[model samples]
Target: MDRKRVNACIEEIVKARKADGGLKQVFWVAAGGSNGGFFPAQYFMDRESKSLRSQSFTSNEFFLAPPSSLGKNSLVILCSMRGTAETCDAASLAKERGATTIALYIEESKLTEVCDYSFAYESISYDETEASEMNASYGLFLAMVLLKKLENYEHFDLAIESFSVLDRVYRDAWNYTLPLAKKWAERNKNESVIWVLAGGPAYGAGYIFSICNLEEMQWISSPTVNTCEFVHGPFECTDKNLPMFILISEGRTRPADERVLAFLKKHTDQNIYVLDAKELGLSRIDKRVSEYFNHLLFSPILNNVYLRALAIAKNHDYHYRRYMWQEKY
Candidate 1:
């Protein structure tokens, strides 16, 4: 991947926005893993940009009831690993509505043909889990570009530098997580149901792992809830024998997650598994950026890898799916 080219493309988009008196809104549209990948970026924009409005939507939802705010002064980002039919239709709708559309994908397809700008990453023989993480990285880049234009986004340079070294960071994260993943898998292999929890940016990681990887791929019953929401009602579902997985973010939301963890430890005798991003030694990543983005970057990828281990431990292939590409949905 040429970092220079990515930067250039971002600059082009920024220049266009400036020439048009600036973009008023941004929409992130996708489905399944791709929709999951948009969460952190959406979070970043919400937290960092004061002037730009951003929203995320499932591809079909966007096409069915398009936002009234979407127009020539809006930017719409679409994602599709294989360019799904729904996403392609949404991109075409976005373009027809006069929004500056950008498609981030791994291949050239209907999505690329419909968008005003398309960025394609090198195609790899990676499963949906791996592709989700890769797409998240691309989404983060898009977020940063918009952030740079909306506000100076003080940490932009450091964030880009940190992203460039994520390959190494991912390796270290996997090395640290492997044994733990295997152990967790062994304990939960026979369990009928499990719960996953996270807060803030890490919520996306928890959601995707539980829904896309565990439930969808492994045919396990898993429910994911925001950590902050745990105490409201979901706490009633906890018990001594239940299994729970918690993803602890390293950012401001850490306290929210810690509060949930403390309550769970004190109240339930259930088996609990926790993965904290701060503990992952991601070399070369900026400390502050790591605090904000590590949970988003590390948790999902690590969870995917962990699921693969769990699949192997249970004598099941992670790629096994009932209705994924094998059957019509």
Candidate 2:
């Protein structure tokens, strides 16, 4: 909703470029529900970043794990929109271990003070609960800025254009998916558990942030799966009454996707939902560009949509900033 804040964060990241001293590795850490899940995916797929190594860490016990875990020359980018204490503690530890520390927080806070550098997006809070959406968008901006600093972006203009495209996509998704997502939430309310499916990178995505956070939010059992695995094994004896959500990305996976759709059709008794940019007819991209963005940004957007719907369904009155800090540090 606040494009200016997102743009400002992006600009700061671009301006902060220093020769990363032959950067070798990166530890991209995020705390919170959706961010913890999506940040790693964003970091890895971002070819512009000089991150030879990357991983997502969740457990507090591992937060202090030796910096050598990321290798000698690692840059620790601690991401927490709400400036969670555990993440601040992790940043402090990473810095003490001689790893360069950076933080992406919603505002300048204690976490920023603990890091070598801090990027604040959305300084003026909107609705405290949904602020994470803004925080997530700012995180994406941070990723883009980091790339601009580290890589020779012949496509800087293109990247800016891509932001506009992304904004439009989010708007469209908000319009179209909300009603359907709410409907699905209603239909699946009685189910004891929900299965979320995506494949390949999306497979990694299925477990990354959103679904896992949804588990915490809804207090319902949610398991993520790669559609390929579901077809290989789980699909064999799935009961009709089960609920599963499929996140489809555009690519050669099309044929495989057809197979999935066919299978879901065959098992019409199962409560199933598909979230995809192309499937939703929401993205504006040429074929080549479509394939690329779909592979990267598509699932995260879908995940956001699902999260928003889940928040509404649960009547948690979810305020993003309310959960700003986790107590476990």
Candidate 3:
């Protein structure tokens, strides 16, 4: 994951911040799954950084109306897999605004050229389940490293050490989750619609599966419901005719997820497939930072097992696209 390169960039940011005393704001900009990838970093900065302000924006929106506070002391991070044109332009705009820009991409492209520094997450060049190299993991790591360097986070040492064991823990999680993922896919593969529910860090994984995996890849009508927002309006569709893919994350907002889960089980007859984070046994991660990593733990299950099985069962290849590259928007 190029931890050394990430460390160098954060050091450089620290140096720049010290020179001007203006490293208070961070903006995460990207599109689609790449935008989802930076959610953890924004959430982390919101929860942990006492002096830092963070925001996440879809690339086009960022280009259209950037925050007025986005200059000098700000850090703009643009993430993408192929470095889509919109995101690359966003990187250029960020650079032009005098913000220190970083591009977190799976590969180097024109977007990387526009940034002050580029770090590869290596999502494509990885095998099986690259625990420390997932999209969200890299963002979280960068946040951790930045906070650790900037403010001397007490548990950062243990959290950094935990990465050494994450791959092994990830393998165990994959093995444990595979059977249930396959079971859920086999039982509900023919369902016409699905409500994918998640909360906290795992929300991005649910977002990816619903938008990128189910709707875009398998041509299924899948809408994502945040567990925190489920009771507001989405819970109205609580009948036996509907199916739900519920994710119970292990993090700050887990109680919200649990509350919605309890309500769903009691009031609805819908076929519910729950992927509880507790069952994944992520004890190998340091307790101080474990909760922040629920997204990484849930990713392999969603990507390789649940989503893949459903695509196979529905006779659709995940790579198939109707109009993504074939038609203009």
Per model, state how many residue pairs clash: 0, 7, 0
User: On a 0 to 100 scale, what is the lDDT of residue 69 in model 2?
Assistant: 57
Query: Using Cα atoms with residue i matched to residue i, what is each candidate's TM-score against the true structure?
Result: 0.92, 0.73, 0.95
Cα lDDT listed for each candidate: 0.79, 0.57, 0.82
Mind giving the per-residue lDDT tens digits that candidate 1 earns over 1-329?
44567678767776787777778888999998778878878888878888888999999999999999888888899999889999999998888888889898987899998888877753222432332237677787788877775688899888877776766666667678878888988998888798888888788778888887789878888898899899899999888798999888877778989998998899874599888876665434676776557545555454556788888888888777777888776
lDDT of 2 by residue, 1-329 (tens): 45455456445533443344444556667654534444424633444455445555652544756445553356666766667767777877886766667676666677888887665554212323232244444455445544555564445456445555664564565567778878876776556687777664345445642344456655557777667677788787566777777777665455565577678888774577777757554346444334334433444444565665666776654444333345532
Once model 3 is optimally superposed onto the true structure by TM-score, how far is the C-alpha of residue 128 displaced, in angstroms?
Answer: 3.9
Please list the residue runs of candidate 2 whose C-alpha ends up more than 4 Å from where it truly belongs after superposition: 1-21, 34-37, 40-51, 59-64, 67-72, 122-133, 136-156, 200-213, 251-259, 286-329
Q: Number of the top candidate by lDDT?
A: 3
In model 1, which regions exceed 4 Å deviation?
17-20, 122-133, 282-284
Model 1 TM-score, 2 decimals: 0.92
Ranking by TM-score: 3, 1, 2
